[model samples]
Target chain A: MSNDNEKDWPLWEVFIQSKRGLDHKHVGSLHAADAGMAIENARDVYTRRGEGNSIWVVKAEHVHASNPDDAESFYDPADDKVYRHPTFYTMPEGAKYI
Target chain B: MELNEALFQFCLRRGDDTHVLSHRLGEWCGHGPVLEEDMALTNRALDLLGQARNYLQYAGQVEGKGRSEDDLAYLRNERGYVNCKLVEQPNGDYAHTIAKCFLFDAWHLPFLKAQLDSKDEQLAAIAGKAVKEATYHLRHSSEWMVRFGDGTEESHQRAQQALHDLWTFTGELFETDEVYTTLQQAGIVPDLGPIKEAFDRTVNEVLAEATLKRPEDEFMASGGRKGQHTEHLGHMLGEMQFLQRAHPGAQW
Candidate 1:
């Protein structure tokens, strides 16, 4: 599709980390033609006051997110896997705090 | 010579330029073409006004006459101010405003970067913090300039016309005077020639990217730094100083 029309700019998801040692959390989505333009649009929209140390922009179409209806099936499986829990095992003697 | 004497004048000039331009930009607060751009312009304007407050407060202290930033800002006469002419022009349209900002911010970023090495500690500190802000201002303004200039035929015509209308006022930014010469000799200010060269390169690059030609052989407007200004400044000062002039020593 030609993205020259006013409504043609594809939506891009914006993820921003406000500082170092922080995870990039999804802030919002804005429309842009490319990743570079998406980053600029995100900066203009989200980070007005030196707020973010890093930014990640992904085309909204490319995000492989599970539907809400599958939340139980996708997430509940890990909850019952108690062997994956670290609390089940005791620490070795004189082991550093974990 | 006393440092405060020169510093007071320098800070007022800096403060006035930012204050006037910020107030002008604030007019676009609710009226930007898009919501993102609306926020962008206002955010930049707020940043400029914040910088103005810092510099003006410093100017008050350097004057050492018990005046506040508001007094320095709102009590000054037209001849006593020293802001450049480009900032006081009316915000005719979005393209015009963006073009004016691109022109000024292009000069300001390098100017502030050089001032980081100033002999005056306070000026250097102010310039150091301001350069970071100025870098973003240049980026935002240049992005709009390029977009509008290359977007559509109507946008292209408007942006190019704005550039031509504002180009005359740009020469005053590089026009030097005795204060600049004295400061430069004393290592307190950067040489204008090099700053002008860098400004030219950056502006030309952006214009080329926008597919717009730079205006040529125009009669350059001058004398803003020396207190001469266009008629627009009178109207601006009238609005800006009305409260202070009406209620002398009024506090909020």
Candidate 2:
């Protein structure tokens, strides 16, 4: 439950990196008065269960996301490009991580 | 007091400090000004609760009794608790809660840090783990203190009022008697002098950044170390221990 008074605070997008070498995946969003608070709130909200070792919080308004309405034009063309698949490459022996 | 008895009392004091404060923070579970804050407060509560369990478990061992952690926590009467009075003060408002937490955390972090070198291995281990949690707890509370003190007209007034109201309780954090003397003489605990200095430094720094004045200790409250507590502890314990009292040895 959120109070009407808290709505005035800016919204921030939270990202959590589960390990040292991992990327910080988008976890969720929360309201904070500033960047420092956003990071702290992200730690509290997203990492309470040892979910992450590091966190990044950016203002939600600052993210430039592709328009959802343009999804067909922006992404659908890639579906038919089977030649772009890397699966056709022959695998080298003992290529562990790959 | 004998060494064992002094150690038992010392452990109980540390345990009770975290336990009572955890219960108080739990009160904010559903009532924080915002949902993120609600979760944040409860997270701190759980961290303190975990530390309380460890301390109480060690305390039970030091007492040479067969009592478990639950027994030490729920079986004790109000006077048996040795937490400082600051932990039991009512959460008046957001500002008041922040003030109480800021003052306690400022003292607590240094106290745990000094404990890291305790001759008692178990205590040193507990303090080692607790220091990490207390560090973040201080950061969280101090951040809120700055925000509340410097944010707006209303917040500034309330923040200042909270500092005044909670100032008296701050003195109890450094009050020492036989329990401390016994432990310090044994090298089981560090001197309170340096801890007090660190507390003063933290408070002064945070308050300066917040643009708030520090309150003077005109009339200091004490006696929590001797199992003396305000009327509030009884009321709080009444609710916290009701289940254990009503059903002895009850378990899931």
Candidate 3:
């Protein structure tokens, strides 16, 4: 579409859940006229080979994320925190929840 | 016509409707107004082609003269096909195409559902699978129609115009002649009277929601079921059949 005539549709992010009890993983993105069409487009584009059991779509502008410029300050502090890891815990034999 | 011949003819009409409509939808391969819409339309086109293949394959078995599905699809001349005249009409604009598909999809859903009760096992099986697809096709096209009908001033005008222009072609879909009458008598096909009524109810509901008037029945186009079609179908067949005709039996 020309800039003067046709306005571009908004971008939407797509997420897909392959199985029950699993989180919907982000697959890719597509452009759609609305949220309804976003889901339809996501299904047609990403799930044609039966790659998903459920789908979630959100307008790209709605998503909030950490600033990439502050990545070093925001992430470097956690890297030295070995306590965040569960490596010190010993597995009880056949402990299902652990 | 004999019952067996009538059934064969009936199936051919159903198959031809899918074939021609599929071809029209295929014209949107890369020309869609949007990328997602392009895929949506072409996927529906592919669905129609799959249904056409099933119908034509069964039609060939009925013919029993060793004609394969490919032969029936690619070999027949224009007049031999019995698709409804509505499907062969051009995909004029986006709204026009959506209006065309919305009309057909709305009618096809019930028609295919009725076919699931066919006495013929093969036809029943085909319809059983096809009805599910028809449901989805109806949803997709009808939703688009609603938006186009009520969306912007320009979109609303375009949609109304498309419906007005295409309304004449809608009548032929439910036209029952000797072929259908014979098939219905033999329990091979359902009575289209109730189906037409059902189609009318659904169409009226959707059109009302869209805030568009059902165009008054003006001049109605007919005769594709009798192997007559608009000038477009001939050109469509020539292009669709060229490769198959030129390279007979050639495959990778």
Candidate 4:
């Protein structure tokens, strides 16, 4: 019954960790009935080519993001702040651990 | 039977099981209920095909007749195949397909795990790799079984019907003959007793969780291991082997 229709399930955001000591990166999204099925769907859809050793899936609905409508006022102030960038300072020669 | 012949038969049985089931699952290429399911089923089919090639290649080598994997796979006729009948059964509905896959995966996982301890190095290695694939396969199928059997009324009825219809064919999975007995005696293969126990435990656990009743094992069918099969195998082979049979040495 759950698989009777694609719309019956909710979309899940998939994150895959390619190897050890790596952060899980958002790959794509797929539909599944629950977290278990979402993890499995993520594995099938994302890890088929040995792309990842670990997977994390969150329901798309649970992933909150800033509204684009507030982008200009909420983010544009940082555009002209050149001092925030480390490029303004010159690095010493042979400074390997910068 | 001679030792070489028994070993060949043993490999062929396992090979044919995966080969035929892969073909059956492949038939769902563009036909799954959803896009995700389509890919998932095809993925399982590919896994089975990989295992099939390994077993079949080993079978050819064991035969020592210079037959390659492709030759044994593409040239085999209906009677030449030794897969159990359960793998050859038609994929009826979604419920039927899940039932077929679940039943087979339950037996397949443990069987391959036992093969990991095989006295023969080749078989042991193959089993080592195959056990991993079969583990996920069993999980997927068993999850689907729970979904179908515990889902809506319609799904419950369909799953029940499919299980009842397919139960009889399961008996042959544990049945043994001289070929298997010989291999078992030589320590090349494990005894069926423990494998059957594992199969039963998994089946009972899954069925209970799914809220589905176990069908009575009665009038069990046999002979697929001996190359005797239902009419289905012939029709399936006609389509599966058509290209190979029609044009000799055809290649991409």
Every model's TM-score:
0.87, 0.96, 0.93, 0.95
DockQ for all models: 0.34, 0.75, 0.66, 0.47
lDDT per residue (tens digit) for residues B1-252 in model 3: 798788789779889999899999999999988878888888899889999999899988998889888889988999898899899889999999999999999889999999989999999999999998899899888888889888899999999999999999999987888888888888989988888998899899889888888999889999888887889899999988999899988788
Stretches off by above 4 angstroms in model 3 are: A4-6, A81-83, A86-98
Q: List the residue pairs that clash in candidate 3.
A: none
* Alpha carbon deviation, residue B8, candidate 4 (Å): 0.6
Between candidates 3 and 4, the DockQ winner: 3
Residue B112 local lDDT, model 3: 90
Q: How high is the TM-score of chain A in each model?
A: 0.68, 0.82, 0.83, 0.77
Fnat per model, in the order shown: 0.50, 0.94, 0.56, 0.44
Clashing pairs in 2: none
- Model 1 chain B scores worst on lDDT over the 10 consecutive residues at B1-10
Residues B1-252 of candidate 2: C-alpha lDDT, one tens digit per residue:
798899999889989999999999999999998888999999999999999999999998888779899999999998889889999988889999999999999999999999999999999999999999999999999998999888889999999999999999999888888888999999999999999999999999999999999997799999888788889999999999999999988899
Per-residue C-alpha lDDT of model 4 across residues B1-252, encoded as one tens digit per residue: 898899999999999999999999999999987777888899999999999999999999999999988899889999999999999999999999999999999999989999999999999999999899999999999999999999999999999999999999999999989998989999999988998999999999999999999999888999999899989999999999899999978999
Cα lDDT of model 3 by residue, A1-98, tens digit:
44543677888999999988788999999998898988888877898788998999999999999999999998989999999999998988997634
Tens digits of per-residue lDDT, candidate 4, A1-98, equal 34555448888999999988878999999988899988988888788999999999999999999999999999999999989989977899987635
Please rank every candidate by TM-score, starting with the best.
2, 4, 3, 1
